[model samples]
Target: MTVENTLELEHLEHPDHDVVVAGGGPVGLMLACELRLGGARVAVLERRTDIDPTLKAGGINQTTAEALYRRGLLPRAAEAQERRLAEYREALAALGGGRLTVPPKFAGHFAGIPLSAELLDAADPAFDGAGPAGEVGAVLQQDVERILGERAEELGVDVRRGVELTGFDAGADAVEAYTSAGRLRTGWLVGCDGGRSLVRKHAGFAFPGTDPEITGRQAVAEMTGTEGLRYGWNRTEHGTYAFGPMPGRFLTVEFDGPPADREAPVTREELEESLRRVSGADVRIQAVHSATRFTDNARQADRYRAGRVLLAGDAAHVHSPFGGQGLNLGIGDAMNLGWKLAAVVRGEAPDALLDTYTAERHPLGAWVLRWTRAQIALMRTDPHAGALREIVAELMETVTATTFLVKKISGVWHRYDLPGPGHPLTGRSAPDLALADGTRLADHLHGGRGLLLDLAGDAAVTDPARGYAARVDTRTVPAASPEETAALLVRPDGVVAWATDEPADAKGLEEALSTWFGAAA
Candidate 1:
């Protein structure tokens, strides 16, 4: 039975919203949009009065790109990416001299070790039918937030900025959130409030992980004597430093430890000291524009959900920003939780479905923690770490190892361990299939509803989903390729719930539909 149907009369009549998202950043905004698309009333509470323009993640991996594309926002994301790339190019041209040469095909890096994109295999099974979703994006964190925020507005999400969620009390039926503005009741409370999540902590969620071992800083500054510093990532005798994707941008990593005062503002003296120590250069900084500090500190919540309060993005997991995984991981978390939570709130699914969020994403989040920890081990200035770095660099030079690392970094190598028939595609992100009608699979997902595609033109395959019309959109289209599956059930988040290589299985299709979409309407 739906939670709303089982709730007491007063509880049903008094709850203010279906879901109230704490923190209106990209993750919260994305989740708010998804909930609206699922026909749920959502409100987003953001602490900041204005968007934070601090320089953060400069790109989105394949998984995040696909999430945007599925919502018809890929074009906007691509435009933002191109604009940033042009600015970077213009900055480099201003330097005139060939101090740094951009690689023709740079995939990404691990432990500051650049991975060449030229080695990626076109025929790799991981990307067989990924289509446009395989493209990585170059948008910054601010741009990402802008894109999601705009979409959230278009979807009629009630976003309240300058309002902070101080604390909340979750009862048997609903959660009463006490914010800086006032108190509001909600069926669910989601903490996308970043690493220092008040919702997660207030809900008594346990957070456990290692402490910081390194202090890293990045900034855009006006400086002199930068010529003495090497281009790109350089691991010197003391620590690591990198110069210029843009002319004035500088980054330094010192292994002594995390900064004594992480909240302290960046100063000209501090930047000069770090640059001199890492590069052994006599660089003098005249002015500092934008700067941020980070550390190797890593942690993840023991669970993503605690009763009616749940967590996403940095609230659920956090690690060193190595491999540009922090933003991508958070985006993945929102996309995974969005539809499921909406289903439960809309009274279309049971709360048991919410448990699947942690089950599926916890393993992946743990893997990311381990992945960043490995980079820290390689980045340490110790002799043992130096030796290990050399070995890893040699392995990265090979096509096989490069391809493997690329898969993991691109966020396309994992799958949800869903219960279904033993089909290779089940539990994996659905391929962007090219239908005979000239539309792709992503075109049908813009409305945030589950999909049932009948490629074999069988009445039985399409008939089983008739009862689920409220939550599933069924389409009978000719197979785009001879080897395409006869039928497939794709969840709203673009995961394949079931697929059949042979003739359509009516009973199996019905069961799969019932399992994921709840009993027929």
Candidate 2:
């Protein structure tokens, strides 16, 4: 049925969207864009009046860039990064007097090791073309949202600002949501709200975790005396101090300590004192853009999905931002869900396919929470905790240990547990390859179709035994080396559900289709 027909005159009183997204941040906007690109009508209900200009997430990893590229928003993201890089270079040049030479390597979220070009190569293949500037990550949260939000709107996503979702009713066929204005119905509802999520609360999803007792102090300031001093960190007699660059004339410093009363202001003297004590430099602080305190809480929803209502980003999990994984993880969640939800909404797949959203994402969220908590614990300044930190940090420096950690923290090592013969491509993300048609693996996903890659020319391999062939795109490729010949059937979300050296078995193909595309022909 057409969208206009689905919403009759009676339904005209309230706007009806194919999918109602309950947040307008990076994740929500990205989800809306992806759904819109997939031919699903989407509407984003944002509580905020306007976009926030604060530079929150300072870096975008290669994994995230690839995900954004798949959605055809990489050019916009790259442009934003270029602007931020110019500002960052200016900040570094001012810090270094008049002349500035790029350092050999700079410290990153990973300690001791400099972010050398070699390190980027070893990290991921996606990092091959990414330059060794601005930490292989971009700064500024506003830039990210601006790029995504603009792209979302350009893609025809209806972004409704100043509208808040107060409650929602999930029915068998549709979800009815009640907002401040009135009631609206949609085929699906996604809660991308942040930590204080109203949708998660109204849906009765349990967020299980504790808020950290220690408070984290973060502020952006203008620095006059400090130039050319690469980002630094020190465990002072008072507490932990970290300073990094921001756009324009701003620098951000974060300190850890007991929670200050929300009404109390963070004085410049306090910031100056902390800088002096930690860096042993007399640094002058000018204007303070924003100052806030936060507790390190590691919490995740019991289930990411509840009937027709689902959660993504901070709405599903909240943890310390030590690793800067919050935004990255949230974006990943949206990328995974967008394609699956679109398939179901288009009636190309059964609703049961949506269940995999929770099965595949829940455990990963819990794992991230545990890892983030451990990283935060290592930053503690207590005497015993300090000793433990040294031991763990030292242990992490070994090649074996560091590689293990790099894989985990980079999120490249994660593989979903899909049922199969344990093919190389099974459960792993399909690597981007230069295809015979001169297209990339990510390019095929633009059609929002399930791809069945056949390395060997065997049509019988993907023969429809019980309603499979009609639901997926099966193609053949010439056999190459073990590495090259390995076939990969990727889902719209970029996950490889079926793969093999030869053609995939009929049973495996059937199971994969039913699991991801549902039991639809």
Candidate 3:
């Protein structure tokens, strides 16, 4: 492709958009959808001609599902997952006669940590069921993008494919993005582009981190005769090799082997030979899909925002796919910033709401990187690491240790430290409570609205100056037990902001509004 063809810029004079998102991947599309729902005119600029073929980032955690569920997008997500499961089953059935059964569903606990399962069960009941044990956690990345993109389009988001952002000028008042087609002027510019983000580079943000010594390789292929085996892994003195059923009569293999020489392509014969060596059997292999190699680099940007241009997803952090967190983390990043950005753009909240994006997400990214590195270290075949891996795996099989590790990997153990006194709901996900007006917390939060639970006497809570606050709907539940009477305040991001028997003092209520609901006085 020529330079012009590769960087096809489509410009719009006085574009009708409040935020111009530079990337149409899952994170970008989801952010666009959220922004549109929050009453922002949004546009997405994507460079790809079509969705990626490889099924990357398989699992979607409960937290992510709850986020989507609150947005009323869970039905779509569930449909996509159902389709993927059916495809997986068909693929397995075609290989032989025995029915391919989905594995028992267990909360992903890492390192034999007992806390992980306990945390997950306590957080959400959706995870309380028998299912699969493998990492086929959710639908593929492409399927997620498809669903998000469709939902975004339905929400009146202008998704411009085949267009790439070349440069952006972030000024005090507005951002002028220069793309392959033309210039787009918007209130803000967010870079949801991948790790090799042009926007991040143009913004001059430094990505500070180191790459792991081992390289990860993944390939999807159709083998003539490898049936009866659900999934298997070979951990030899040299390296680690694993393969499992894919969507078609295909199997996906992942190998932690020696890094290939500079930009050298991994041949089909090499993949087949590796399968033979690892499986210890003769297998007919056809390269239906090519193997791709990537380094297990863990890095995050020095900062998430430079003036008005901000970074999220792979633009902000990159790490190994150890916990199947790459996509989930990206979606969470979009969720964390979407409502805050909407509040700022609408002048409902102070610019300080934007500050929390980095404050909150940066730490989570660091945690993910640390845990992913630990998992990678445990999986290494080096003689020194081998001894450590055996000890760690053995320890992980224990209930307590396994649960702790599981929580870390599943991301259920994370709790945001919001400014509030100790309450059951504080710093946790707000429980879905039904209101007197027949509206539930999830229903009201469909469009990224902050909610105040008035469990105290039904004294009206109102702010005449703030439209959202004045129109805030309060639900009064009859006092049951002392445990049930505690009120909960939920932020737009679905995190508990404040909880008490009555409203905090006027000063506390005012501060909560100022921090989350964009009330300024």
List ranges where model 1 is wrong by over 4 Å: 1-15
User: Relative to the unseen true structure, what is the C-alpha lDDT of residue 60 in candidate 1, on a scale of 0 to 100?
Assistant: 86
Q: Write the per-residue lDDT of candidate 3 for residues 1-521, one digit (tens) a residue.
A: 33533433343765868899999999999889878867788989888867877647766875677677778777777777888878777766775634345544545533212222333333243222112212234667777788887788778898888888899888999999887778889999999999888889999999988766666566777665565323534465545555553532322223353365737876677666665655555677765564655666889998898889899999999887756788888888998898888878877777888899899889999888887777667666567767887777676656556555555555556668788566655666666665556555677677677776665554433332145554244545533323353456678777877776654333255566666776543
Sort the candidates on TM-score, descending order: 1, 3, 2
TM-score of each: 0.95, 0.84, 0.85
State the lDDT at 498 in candidate 3.
73
Model 3, residue 71: what's the lDDT?
A: 80
The 10-residue segment of model 2 with minimum total lDDT is 126-135
Q: Rate the local accuracy (lDDT) of all candidates.
A: 0.87, 0.69, 0.69
Candidate with better TM-score, 2 vs 3: 3
- lDDT for predicted candidate 1 compared with the true structure: 0.87
TM-score of 1: 0.95
